[model samples]
Target: MRILSFNIQNLRLRQGAGQPRLDGARDRDEIGEASALDPADRRLSAALLAEAKADLVLLQEVFDTDTLDWFNTRLLPAAGLPSYPHAHCPPGNDGRGLDLAVLSRQPVQLTSHANVTPSDLGLEAPQPGLPVFRRDCLMVETGGLTVFTCHFKAPYPDPDTAWPVRRAEADATRRIIERHIPAPSQGLWLIAGDLNEPFEPDAEPAIQPLLPPFSTDLMARLPEDERWTYFDSHSGRYGQPDALLASPALAARWPDAIPQVLRAGLAYEATRHRGAHLQGVGRHRPHASDHAGVLLDLPGI
Candidate 1:
């Protein structure tokens, strides 16, 4: 089975001239523009989604069911792709309405962990009391597969505070997933999205919850230079924050299933992103999303 993950940078509506847009919008529920699909960045995003030929898609930064439906029914088809029959969009905790969403061609069941906070998980409050996941962990099931799509706390300009919080969130996510898999027959699972961390050999941040005995980052086999899924012009640093981390059982079953970053959709330089921004809406370049789409092919059992 082919699965793709993308944090489509707030796929909201086209904003009115005086309305709040994606960049400056404070309200998470803001439906900025009429449809971002008409823009170049969104078109590039749609094209990449089509290229993956995935059976299922886990999308981040979606506004809600209506926005996801607009993407699935309008954007995907406009990009010359078949519409996904089954889609699930349960709002997450993000204030920007940047919720986690899933689209599948096959039937699947969904459960939202949006209300699963630190207190519910019985974990100490990292900061008085914060939500366990930065965004909701969407548990998606189809056949013998269970996929948990998450968008961890973003490593913003600040690293010290964000690091610990991210770690705590990761630990919480891992614990939650583990609580469900009591036996092997429960089937294989994986977590995919813009998890805001790196898998670099010398990477300082600890992503232990999504590593080793917990799960394996399938992008490990790629060369270092090719590992990046995002390019930050301001920092001049390239990172692979988005990933398709899989269960040990699933990896063993589909050993050849390696995750791939679709770099073709991203610009090679930061200047291009700026140029796109200057050029106007619809010009993708560096601004589509600082992140790229990561796709993995899982062999059918």
Candidate 2:
């Protein structure tokens, strides 16, 4: 099974006067005056997905089910890719409607942990009684693999304030996986998503609970210099927020399977990657997303 994990940056469908339009791959704070190249952005996004041709696609920052369905049916076909028969997007905790989504050719069973509070998991929330996850830890079971797809809290406005929340989220995710799988080390499972790890090199990682000994960091298989999957246009910093963490058993089964980081959709401004770009990708606009897509090929899974 070929699986792709991508953070399709704030993919929201808006009801325009003429027809519904999808939001560009830019945040509200980033847009000062330049007109959004939404159509071009989505075109590149679809193009990259078409190129990957993954059997199971795990996506983050999608708006809702309607948006996912529309993109699956409309944009995908236009990009020469068939629409996935199984697509799901459950509402998450994000106020802006950004949610986790999945697209698969095979059947899938999905469960949401959006409302799981700290007390439910016996963990202390940064804020009393609040949910541990900023968005959700979506559990997807398909093709003999139990996939935990998540989008953790970003180290935004204040990294210090966001640390504990992300830590709790990581701890809760580990607990949830252990509770469900019984013996995750022996199970066929993996966690795939944009972890939103902080850019601070000196600070301790909040996502350590999900790392090594518990799950193998598949991205580490790449050369250290090529591990980055996200580019911060603001700070010009490159980070590997996108991850494909596999269970020990799964990683052992496919030790040679290194994830393919698809950067064709990223903007030209992310110059660290000297790879070929998709047609029409500009300096900062007309791009697929701020983060590149990560594809892992697990044959005969």
Candidate 3:
């Protein structure tokens, strides 16, 4: 099975006086005015997904089920890709309505852990009684593979203040995985999503509980220099927030499977990636997303 994980930045569908329109791949904070390239941005986003041709696509930052459905049925076919008959987007904790979504050729069983609080998992909460996950940890089971797709809290305005929340989220995720899979080391599972890890090299990682001895980092199979999947256009900094972490058994089974980071949809401003861009991708506005799509080809379930 070829699985793809992408953070299609803030994909929301809005209805105005005319036909409905999708939001561009930019945050409101980035620009004071609406982008003229909203259509171009979504087209590139669809184009990149078409190119990947993944059987299972895990997405982050989608608005809701309606948005996912419209994109799957309309934009996907318009981009010369077949519609994903099965798509899911459960409401998450994001205040802006940015949610986790999935698109798959085959049917999938999805469960949401959006309301799982730190107290429920026996973990101390950073903000008492609130959900541990910043967004949601969506569990998708398909073709005998269980995938825990997450969109962790970003290390934003203050990494220091954000640390505890992310740490609790990581710890909660670990506990959830442990409860679901009796022996995760022997299970056929993987965690795929934008972890939103801090970019500072020396800073302690909040996602440590989900790394190494617990689950193998599949991105590590690539050369260190090639592991980056996210680009900060403002700071001109590159980071590897997108991850495909596999269970030890799964990683052992596919020892040579390295994820393919598709950057064709990125903007020209992300110059560190001296590669091709999708047609019409401009300096920043007309782009698929700030983050590249990460694809993993697991031949068999």
Report every candidate's CA lDDT. Answer: 0.72, 0.91, 0.90
Off by over 4 Å in 1: 14-38, 126-130, 183-187, 198-204, 268-287
* Tens digits of per-residue lDDT for model 3, 1-301: 9999999998999998888999989987866645678989999999999999999999999999999999999999999999998999999998788799999999999989999987888887656588778789999999999999999988888888778777788898899999999998999999999888877743568889999999999999999999998888778899998988999999999998989999999989888789888888888768999999999999967
How many clashing residue pairs appear in each of the predictions shown? 13, 0, 0
Q: Write one digit per residue (lDDT tens) for candidate 1, span 5-57.
A: 88777677545686532332112333353344336666666777887889999
- In terms of lDDT, which candidate is stronger, 1 or 2? 2
Off by over 4 Å in 3: 126-128
User: Ten-residue segment with the worst summed lDDT in candidate 2?
Assistant: 28-37
- Against the true structure, candidate 1 reaches a TM-score of 0.83
Using TM-score as the yardstick, the better of models 1 and 3 is 3
Residue 38 lDDT (model 1): 33
Better of 1 and 2 by TM-score: 2
Angstrom error of the Cα, residue 185, model 3: value is: 0.4
